[model samples]
Target: MTDYETIVYVERESVARLMVTALRAHGFSPREILDGGLPGIGTGLTGKGLAIAVPASEARDAQPLAEALLKDMVGK
Candidate 1:
């Protein structure tokens, strides 16, 4: 809870929103997520890409979910 780490970068706007929502449903914190696709932003998750953050300790669990989401989105 001290700090969150940016664990993955998702390029699609829709996918990024889904990732943040799904991660919360899966028990991650809203505060821990950074949706790069958020409107009206200037930097970071803005134009760079949809970047997501999670507790460093939770990265192990986050990895698979992130991968699966990205895989599913990319495959479509």
Candidate 2:
């Protein structure tokens, strides 16, 4: 669990927060990677997008749940 593996990317911070809650409920320590898109300013400065990631050791187990949740939220 030394490294983190990104599981899904979402455009909205609200969505990322939802994913964080879902992952926490599943007993996973999820981390948020915020790439631009500040509160009022869409896409922020970086414009790289937002991401939800889990520790490398838990990635395999967390990926499916993360993807399912993201798909449900964004339809992608």
Q: What is the C-alpha lDDT of each candidate?
A: 0.68, 0.78
Q: How far does residue 47 in candidate 1 sit from its true spot (Å)?
A: 7.6
TM-score result, candidate 1 = 0.66
Q: Estimated TM-score per prediction?
A: 0.66, 0.76
Residue 13, candidate 2: C-alpha displacement in angstroms? 0.2
Instruction: Report the number of the highest-lDDT candidate.
Output: 2
Q: Model 1, poorest ten-residue lDDT window?
A: 29-38
Top candidate on TM-score is 2
Show model 1 residue runs off by greater than 4 Å.
30-48
Write model 2 residue lDDT over 1-76, tens digit each, in one string: 2688888666777788888999999999988545554467543355655667888988999999988988988888
What is the alpha-carbon lDDT for the whole of candidate 2?
0.78
User: Given candidate 1, what's the lDDT at residue 54?
Assistant: 78
Clashes of 1: 1
